[model samples]
Target: MNTQLMPSVSVEDITRAHLRLKGIVLDSPLQYSHRLSEIYGANIYLKREDLQEVRSYKIRGAYNNMSLLSDAQRAQGVVCASAGNHSQGMALACAKMGVRGTIFMPSVTPQQKVKKAKAFGKEFVEVVLVGDTYDDAYAEAIKAAETNGWTFVHPFDDLNTIAGQGTVGLEIYSAANFPIHKVVMAIGGGGLSAGVGSFFKALSPETEIIGVEPKGAPSMYESLRAGKIVNLEKIDSFVDGAAVRQVGKINFPIVQEVVKEVILVPEGQVCATMLDLYNEDGIVAEPAGCLSVAALAKLGDIRGQNIVCVIGGGNNDIARTSEIQERALLWAGLKHYFIVEFPQRAGALRDFLHVLGPDDDITHFEYTKKHNRAVGPALVGIQLSDPATYDDTMKRMAESGFKTRAINKDSTLFEMFI
Candidate 1:
C-alpha cells in the first residue's frame, strides 16, 4: 500500500491547467436540466464536457501533457495510442501546438473514426491502425516510444495526464455558484475519474462522488469490491469506450478514497438514457457519455442537492447508431424476439402472421432444417408499438392449439446462442 504513487493532485494544478487551456479549448456547456432536477430530486447540472474541441474531455489532458513538452522534445514529436477520442485529442492538440504526433489505434476501429482521426491530425500527425484492441496498439506505441525516443503521451495514469484532466473539476467548481453536493461520472480507464475526484477532494471534500459503469463491463466496481485491481476473465464490449477489464494502476487508489459509490448500470439502461438524452434534451450522447445520466433511473431518491454529471465523450460511430437505437427499443420493451417452436407440418407461418395486428411486424425470420428431426424452431423478431401486445399474442397462441415461448424464456434458451 504505497501511497507515494497516488500523490493527490491539487486544485491549483487544475486551475492552472484551465487557465492555460482557455484559448485552446471551448467552454463546454453546463446546462441546467429542470426536468432532470425534478425527476432525480436533485438540482442536476449536465457538464457537457463532451462538447469540447475534440468532442471529448481527453483533449484537456492531452494538451496539458503536450504543453509541458520542452522546445527540444516538441521537435522530435509526441506519440501514443488510443481507441478514438484520445487520438482525436492528441492529433488536434499537436497540430494546434505546432508539434508532430503519431497515434496508433485498434485495427477494428470504425472507418469513421479513422477518417476523423486523420481529419484532426491533417499533416501535423500520422495515424496508424495497428492491432485488434487498445492493449495491442499500446504495446506498439510503447515500442515506438522506446525506439524513436518520442514523448509517450499516455491517455491516463501519468502525472501530467491526470493534472490535465483535473481541468474538468476546475470548470465544475468555477461554474458552480452554489456548492455542489454530488458529482457523477462514467469510469473506463479511470483517468477522468481520478483527475476529477482528486480536484474535488481538494476543493469540495464534502461533495459525494459517484462513478458509473456498464453492467457488462463492471471492472472498476468488481475490482473495488476485491480491494485490488484484477483482470476480468470476460467482458462485454457493448460500451466500447467504457468497457475495461482492469483498473489502471495509477488511478485506482485516487478514486477509492474520494468516490462514495461505484454503480454498475445495465447495458440496456444505458441505451435508454442515450435515447432519452437525445429525444428530450436534443443532446447527442454516445453510450459511454450517457452513463451518469443513465444512473438517474435507478437512483430512486435524492431530494434537494446540487449534482453534476460529466458527460464524457461523443466519438460515436455513426453506423452503430442504429444498433444503439435498437438496444434502446429492446430495453424499453418496445422490441422483442422469440423462437416459436411449432409443428413443421403445414402453413404455420401464415397462421402466426395472421394472429398479429397491423401494427406488429416481423423484423427477422430464421428457420433451421433438422437433420435429426423432432420439431422445428423458427426464430422470429417482432417490433410493436405496445409491449402488452405480447400477452394477447401469447393468449391467442395458446387457444389456437399452437405453443409459443419467448427465446429469452428459461426453457427456450435461443437467445444464449448469440
Candidate 2:
C-alpha cells in the first residue's frame, strides 16, 4: 500500500488532536497485564481507555470535534448518533463547551449508558431514543441534522473524529517502555482502528495493527475482503458498542491501508472475555470493551512478544450480568438446551435424569402436560461441570431411548426458547 494514497488523517493531524485533547481527555494508563501475559506467554499490556472520565476513549474524538466548531456552529448546536460511549463523550463535550446538543441513540442501548449521557450533558443536551440499532439511529440523526440545520458530530466518520481517536495510538507509542510487536483494538465504524492504525504505521512501522469485530457483525471484516465498503443487512446487537452495519466511508480506506488484519470474534467469546476481565482482572468491560482481548486466542503464537489490547470502554450495565454469564456458558459448551419428549408417567423425569453425568445439573425445565398424548415435550436446560462430557451425555440420552433434540445447535429454536 502506498503511503501517499492514505487519507488526510496524518500523524501530524493526530498530534494536533492530541494537543487539543490534552486537558479534556485523560492520558489513560498503559498498564502491563500479568494475568494475560502469563496465559499468552506474551508481554501483554492493556491500554486503559476505560479509565477516562466517560469510561471510554470517545471523549478524545467528541471533545476535539466539538471544539473545532465555529462560533455559529456552536450556537446552532450539534447532533450525533451513538450506541453509548460516543453519546457520553458528546454529552460531556456539550456541557463543557456550553453548546446545546441533541443525541440520538438506539432504543436497545443499555439504560445505564443512556442515563450517564444525560447526566453528563445536564441542561446542554437532549437525549432522543429512536430506532433499534446504531445504523437506524444514524439515519434518523442525519435527517434531523439536515432538517434542523444543526452541525452533525459524526461518531466515527469525520476526519477530526478519526484524528482525535488516534491520540490513543499516540499515547501508546509514547508510553511504551519497550518495542510493541502488536496492538489490538475493537473496530466499530472503524474510527479507532483507522486513527490508531495510521499513527502506528507512520511512526512504529513494524508494529502490527490488528482490529477485532464481533463475529455476528463483521462490517469491517467483510468490507476488507470485498475491497470496498459493504453494508450488512443485519447484525447481532449484543455487543452494542461495537456492532454496526457498515464501516465509516472516511475510516474504511485508512484502515485498509494501515491495519494488517481484522479478526472476527464470536459474540459468545466476547462475553467470556468480559467475565474473565471482571473476575480475574477486576475490570468491568462492556462486551465491545473485551473484544481485543477475546481475539488474542486467534493470534497464534505471540510468546515473548510485546502486545497491547485496548479495552475500549467500561460502560457495562450490571443488569446485563445474567445474560453475559449465559452467553459465556453457552460458548464454553458448559450449557446446553434441549427439547426432550418424555412419557407422561410420574417416573419419566427421574428416568431422564439417569442419562446426565454425575456432575451435570439442570438449570431450566419447563413442561406442559398433554392430556391426550402418552408423551409430552419438555424444555430442558442442562449445565455441565466439564464441557467434554457433552458427547457422553448425548450418548446416554440416545441409549436411554428418550426422544431429544438439542436447541443450542439451532439458532431459530435457541432464540424462540432461550
lDDT of 2: 0.94
Model 2, stretches more than 4 Å misplaced? 1-6
TM-score of each: 0.90, 0.98
Instruction: Count backbone clashes in candidate 2.
Output: 0
RMSD of each: 2.8, 1.1
lDDT of 1 by residue, 266-365 (tens): 8877888887888888887778898999987665567887889889877777788777877777777777777677677677787778757568888788
- Alpha-carbon shift of residue 260 in model 1 (angstroms): 1.2
Residue pairs in candidate 2 whose N, alpha carbon or C atoms collide under 3 angstroms:
none
As for model 2, its CA RMSD to the true structure in angstroms is 1.1
